[model samples]
Target: MDWEPHARRLADTVLRRRESRWWNVLASTPRHVFVPAWWEHGTSGPVARNGPDDPAAWLKTAYQDTTLITRMGTRHADHTTPGTLLPSGPWPTSSSTLPTLLVTMYRHAMLGPDSHTLVTTGTGYGTALACRRLRDPSLVTSIDIDPYLVTAATERLDAIGLHPRTAACDITTNLPGEFDRIVSTVSVRPLPASWLHGLRPGGRLVTTIAGTGLLLVADKADDGTANGYITADQASFMRTRHGDDYDTASPPPSVWDAADGDGDTVTTSRYPLLDVQNTWDIRSMLELQAPGIEHRFHRSTDGPRTAWMAHPDGSWARAAAPDRRTSPLVHQGGPRRLWDTLETIRDRLNRTGQLPVHGAQATITPDGQTTLRRGRWSATL
Candidate 1:
């Protein structure tokens, strides 16, 4: 069976809704060469998919707009057994990001003919795409913190006769090279100062903020600062890992279990229960008001809906109702009223008829301080 025609069809279908700026690269690149095995989040946890064991399935999944989890926690799919157990949830340490999101970041970066690019390499499929577009391994530098990942990606890129500058290093620390465009598939909290220092004047950077699905786009100015606006479209990726696992964002057992318990201030919710993460504006605003808050949602077969929102700052809120159309009974506890803050932000958005976060401006100072401002609200992350 010829896979090239299938790859071309996949690219045509996936790029139908977006600009066809990268159809050629996706159509020609062989995804299975980069991602041989991956995992899927199951009801209990993640289950591994051995690509070589099923070539047809691998070809189909590789071209879809889905994230292939190449590494779970510390266990790479290449090294995992059928009974290997991870300590926690199927947290993806590294993977090939969704193709749509990858293209979105690249589109936002707006690379030019003379632009030198810096990108993060996970499975290296993205680096392959970049090399295809930029047409030079010399103009692209891709890095990952895990030496194993870097080595594997280097080997895979070479297998396809495409070689870019691949390195193992912490992206937040000293970068590998100067770049006209810095695009990261992994998320970071505050914009890294090193990125600003490494970006040539008038260069652009596109990346997602950790803990929220906010895409940050900025351009370096002559004053040694980078400033840009948030895009309305949302995209998120795994947070940059240092050693192996990500820092736990799960709330304490007490706070998580008693999320619906009484609080310092309790009242009816201004709006119905919502999956904040699904909304770019609401999630971004809540993340700003209460940093590092964990959110969850559940519903019975034919009963009420429950939304649990918790923060590491000892705050949690539960909104419950028989139907989502009706207002939810809310319970909150902590020094800070997280639900109230979310409601306030939502109310402000309702009044203003738009989210400030949608087009909020971001500024990164020379020393690495990052700030987001819209109207009178400004937050330094």
Candidate 2:
């Protein structure tokens, strides 16, 4: 069955419910061709999905407007045999980001006909779209830290009658070349100085901050600096890696389990129990306030809301609510009160009636010193 039409419809809805200039490119390009096989997120672990074995299901997943897990830990789906039971512990190392999110990032760049863009390479699906949009593959240069990914993506692009400059390099350490627009699907901690050096004056950069949904869309200035604001659209991406996997291993339950107990301060919270992962505004604020706080949530069989948060600094919080009508029982431990900080933020939001992060001013210096200021409060990236 032809899946191009189905893919096009999904792409339109993702691009603000309007017909995008890149619509035709998205329509014609066959995404399944690039990702013949992939890993699907399964309850037990990463499950392998084969293309030739189940062509129909493959088309359905390939055309869907969702991310397809392509790698788990350092094991790639392409390398895994079909129907194999893969270990689930390691976090997803790579994926073909939902087509919609790719459209959003492209739109954020506000690309011009003659624009030259430096982009990140994952499955090369986004790279293909960029090539199709510009109609000149040479105008686009893509990079990935994995040599295998770079080689496979290049070969796949060639198979589809499209070719662009692709490289295997650590983007944070050094960029491939100067470009008018620098867009990264991977998240970074502090804005990389190498990125600023690679972006031409009067150009734009769109990316997310590591551990947060904050999207930094900035443009280069004549004075060797870049400034912009956080987009209201909260976006998340895997942190950039210098090697096959993330440098910092996932935290064990022991680090956070200690915080789930009766804490130094045990009291009723003013608000209902909330899962930070589900709340964009408050989640982004908390991540900005305290970066690297792992968030999680659980529900009892009878339906009590329970939320937990833990950080590397030994800060942890747990909140539980018996029902919607009752306030949440709060517990916090460690050097900082995790729940209390969240409540303070929620309190500020209650009194101030707004989140300053949306459309807040963002400034990045040449040396990569970045800051975000909104009203009286300010924070460094």
Candidate 3:
């Protein structure tokens, strides 16, 4: 079947939302080509899907403006290519971040026709959007830590009749050159000093600051410091992958045995354990501040629901309810109280009418450590 109509429909969704002038990039960019083989999690290894073979399903998902994790567990989908189902571990390696989120990021970067840009490439989706917006292959440089992803994105962009300089390099260690703007699709722990140094004076950089609840949109100062505001928005892309994604596992027996079952009281939650992927506010905030925390919610046939949030940092929370409309009795334990953090932020939002993000001051150290200070509360990640 022809795919253009489906692409148009997806573009229509984006346009209706007034998200991006570059929405056609989503329609024109052949997502399936870049993501021919991808992994999805199940009980065992990730289930693999073939774009050419599963054209209908592929077209449908590709057009929906949703993020698709193209790699999972330990496997890099680009390297493994199309074959059969691959083993999935416990972490996502790469993804096509949802179209709207991609648009928001680019829009936030404030790229203009004169801008020289550097972007991180995972699935090449965001790079495609950048090329579409700037329309100058020479102005955009896309880099990836994984040589395999860089290679694949290079070929796919070529196939689509778009070309930007693509490189296999570590962005955290060194940026290829000074840029008028830098936008990263990956979550990073801080605004790399290299990025600040590599930015032309007065150039702006937009990226999700890793391991925290923040996004930084900053301009380089004369002294090489980039200062900007923390956006009220939150986003979390997979952290730039290294050789592998998953870390050594903690003993499951100890995890369960140590789980607090005491005042970890069980009660009803005011909201359903939100499938954050479907919720805009919380998901964006979570992405900006605390990406990679996984959520598990159990709902019974009788409407009883229990939700658990777990993070790699040894944090976990259990919140449950007998029905859909009550506040949950929450139980939390770990090095840090994960739920407490969430609730604390939520409370700040409730009382102050907003969380401290927009207009928050961002100071990027030469070492790449970023500290976002909002009034009396300051956070670093």
Best by lDDT: 2
Which model is ahead, 1 or 3, in terms of TM-score?
Answer: 1
lDDT of 1: 0.84
Writing each residue's lDDT as its tens digit, candidate 3 over 77-173 gives: 5446565565533677678888777777888899899899999888887898889889887899999887778888898889888899999887787
Candidate 1 on 1-381: residue-level lDDT in tens?
467976787788768743576998888888888888887666667777777788898888887878888898788987876434454654789999877788788989997877899999999999998998888877899999999989999999999899889999999999987899999999888778899889999999999888787899999999999989889878888888777687776678888877866766679987878877677778877877678888888987657898888887678888888986889888888766778888998898889887677688998998778889989888888
TM-score of each: 0.94, 0.95, 0.81
lDDT of each: 0.84, 0.85, 0.72
TM-score of 2: 0.95
Residue 31, candidate 1: alpha-carbon lDDT: 84
For all the candidates, what are their Cα RMSDs to the real structure?
Answer: 2.1, 1.8, 4.0
After superposition, candidate 1 runs with Cα above 4 Å error: 17-21, 82-90
Ranking of predictions according to lDDT: 2, 1, 3
- At residue 266, candidate 2 shows an lDDT of 92
Candidate 3 deviant stretches above 4 angstroms: 17-20, 40-45, 78-88, 211-213, 246-253, 260-295, 309-319, 325-350
